[model samples]
Target: MSSTLAEQRAEWRERIAGIGDTLRAESETNEDLRQLSPATEAALRSVNAFNLCSPEELGGVNAHPRLQTQVIADITSHDSSAGWCALIGAHESAWLASRLPDSSVERIFAHSDERWPVTCGSIAPEGEAEQVEGGWMVTGRWGWASGIHHSDFILSMSRITGQEPEPGKPPPLLCAAAPKADVVVEDTWHTLGMRGTGSTHYRYENVFVPDEMCLAGFERPPLRGGGWLARPTVTFLTAAGYGFPLGVAKRAVEEITRQATEHTRTGQRASISEQQHFQGDLGRCVALVEAMEGYGHHLFEELLAAPINSLEDAVRMDDRARAALRWAHQTAEDVVRTAHEHAGGPAVYSDNVLARLLRDIQTVSQHVIQTQSAYIRRGQHQLGIPVRPGL
Candidate 1:
């Protein structure tokens, strides 16, 4: 790694570490408010956490994918919602900077002198875009708009009206970016966990997105950035996806460990830590989390070294990256569950740290990318079975 990049990583590590206490302190408020507390948001902004994946030329850190994952993991170790928001915002910023036209990129990043812009959107083609004189008129509501509450620009994927694809091809999709003012953020974020992500519904009603502010499809090559951004979007995003679950699981393990030392269950003479059963469970959880982290790091290293010279190469890399993610998600969920279960009665309370960690990890495990179908597809690929594209 270049010295400059190494230095940037170190700086980011220190900055995120410094805010650990604040993130933890604000966790309750963030959950209660169903969004990040102002303090938490400001602390993250101060660290430039939301720009880690964006282009350096656009005044973003543009850290390596591994570094980005570590940053998110570290932040998530403190607060899962903060970590989720950071990852989503960083990825969206990178996508907009690398995929949108130069004019739109400049418009979004140029004027943000105080802080780099935060972008959040839904990638599902839930909206419709009709071609107009100067651009497309978008109208539809999209769910799971994570971090949309604080985004400066919101992107929505829409199908072009009256456009059809050839046989064996999918419908034509366009991604349109509109200023936050143009989008209506509906209060639909209430959920089982990860509430601070504010992943609510957002709608664009005939919102005019200029031609320059739209990208034809997600598979297009980056308009800017180094070789790292050239990988398929799935591979590029795989690393960041590891952070949320790992961080939350790590925190759960820590919380249980701390609880064991100080708290004893009713009718039990010894502290939780002194019990062989608890020790065994905690040891297994620790090992599982460590294994997940080590595997994720190894996968990223392999990805960096692997060449992607052809479509087949890209598909192979995507398969491995996504498969690793699915495994990590499952492992993390297991670790969190063990931790929560061993934490005993206190863990059932809403204010318990393990309770929150359990909820957050469970919510993350439900994400589309972490589903079991990914494993089936990877198995099919290995067995020479015909797997559908984009599975």
Candidate 2:
């Protein structure tokens, strides 16, 4: 009998779990070299771990952010870097599909050559898109384009001529689709962790994006396209993007608990789990994760209920979603730190999994969404205070 989608997902989950041991080892070596191993990349592709975020109709698992984050958490428990890359890559196409015209969905998925997700982002307005007869001529370089090494397409962000966004005005965040032929990967992903993700810089010179390929909120009834984007953009993709850290944090908590149960200090005969102080720490970590999980669930439910194109209706929910992300990352940081501390001196050892988990968690927590300024803005908005500009 053929396997159901749920069964297939379970099978893939098991495969990812099995590779965790190898990924853990490779990630350590990659950290030393500041690059991911080709073997690791192949391992991710073999099990189809990058399709977790695709739409159900598109041969993807089509999991919600809550379930998707849980899956990523499971994978990262054994190897944070692998989970990070896998989740981010899988979601790229899903996000793009949501913004595209309904008629284009079949073609995007029908393209047999389009394997892997299209990971691209640059909000600095570095790329310029000039309006043309049928489409726009996009030309510029975008930094930090992840998952492109193996991705079949690129979703480049660019700035176009438009009026200054007014209060309550939801301006379009321009995204231009390009095949591999139109883009060049610069191999410039040198970082503290997630180095193996191959998040390289990309260069686009005079790439002509057809009107049918360009995605913008103003271009409704998208030129014979098809995908999830029949509605608004910010309310959907922004919520999805926040799930990555939640996965990383969940793994950090689980690893800490497992280590606490198995390992013992040199002078102590009993494991760290037997100590009362350690018990409190582990218990608190559990509570922290539970809290984040609750916050995330509530925000997702709110997002699901929000009407498409109802920005006014979504403003409060959007603020809540941002707050949830901030809380999740903060909780993750605390849990990971506590876990690292419980691991004692071994946590700092290059070969130890705890060391890498610490680095990965820290790297994600530093993202702007989880920063103090983002949280303050959300909180003030929620409280009806006048939030300053440039937040």
Candidate 3:
């Protein structure tokens, strides 16, 4: 009578596979536009690909992490821009689903089959909220707010200037949502890669959000749906953030393999795939990608299983996932670079898949969650050095 979860996932996978051909065809256009085309966005919505881990009550499929990761990575194999958007859109949906209030979540999923009412958020408080009767008037500029162009609603974190909540704690930071009309999006996302994400700077000038739309920073206790979002923020973010890099590396290897099979150097007597050097490099790159991806997923399983009730447990969880992500991110870069080198001169062209992967991998690698500097923090904590707060 009803499709099994496995069947639905299989269908979704097939849809993803189908979209790859189209996305590959439009990769350059997406790059040129600095955002996914409206048609492409609609295509993504048709599959409900954006809300992979949303609560079932909220009308999302609540896709298992394994399938979700695979879908994101697989899409990346055909087109980095499309894959990048998919990763970000789904990642944002899941992350927001975990953090938003129940009332907000209900409204977000008011329509079961549609992709609208999604919200994007930021790291630190960027807005300054002045107290008002119903809620507060927030004003500030937040940069690199990804998913803005596609979002119907946006939540900006803001500091409440007039409150001294607790003795040791600084002024409370309030994360609240407002309609898209409240924002003045500045075109600031011109970039070498992931340009299709529409990560622009949005400004809020005294935008008022009701108290219900506001999520209290510290006192909040997973107020929204809890069962499906059992894992802590660290578990979701570190894992999702690294997905793009993993996809990039995978795509690079695939492109290199295809190239090696089809072409050879000017003076070479054999196709690149027939050459020993290309064989060694391809094998090495594939192994590197697999090892990092495997180990990352393993740690992800441990991360989900780890208790996050206490501060100590939370730190451990963050550290474990962070360590895995750091290694994977660095390894992905190395693997992509190797593949690029193996592709040689052909990798330099704008239309070349290897060239795009090279750019996309490097861009996603620079993300704060996957940055190499995380290693320093991890090493400091391990060696008994007093690392900064929130390490």
Instruction: Say which candidate scores most in lDDT.
Output: 1
How does candidate 1 score on lDDT?
A: 0.85
Candidate 1 lDDT by residue in tens digits, 247-291: 887898889999989888899999999999999998899898888
Better of 2 and 3 by lDDT: 3
Kindly report which residue pairs in candidate 1 clash with one another.
Answer: none
Task: List candidate 3 segments past 4 Å from native.
Answer: 1-11, 95-98, 164-167, 216-220, 384-391
The TM-score of candidate 1 is 0.96
- Candidate 2 versus the native: TM-score? 0.80
- TM-scores of all candidate predictions against the true structure: 0.96, 0.80, 0.91
Misplaced by over 4 Å in model 2 are 1-25, 29-39, 46-48, 101-107, 112-117, 161-173, 218-235, 238-243, 261-271, 307-309, 386-391
lDDT of 2 by residue, 273-355 (tens): 89999989888888877777677666665566656464444455445566677777777778878888888767888666667
Best by TM-score: 1
Instruction: List the candidates ranked by TM-score, beginning with the highest.
Output: 1, 3, 2
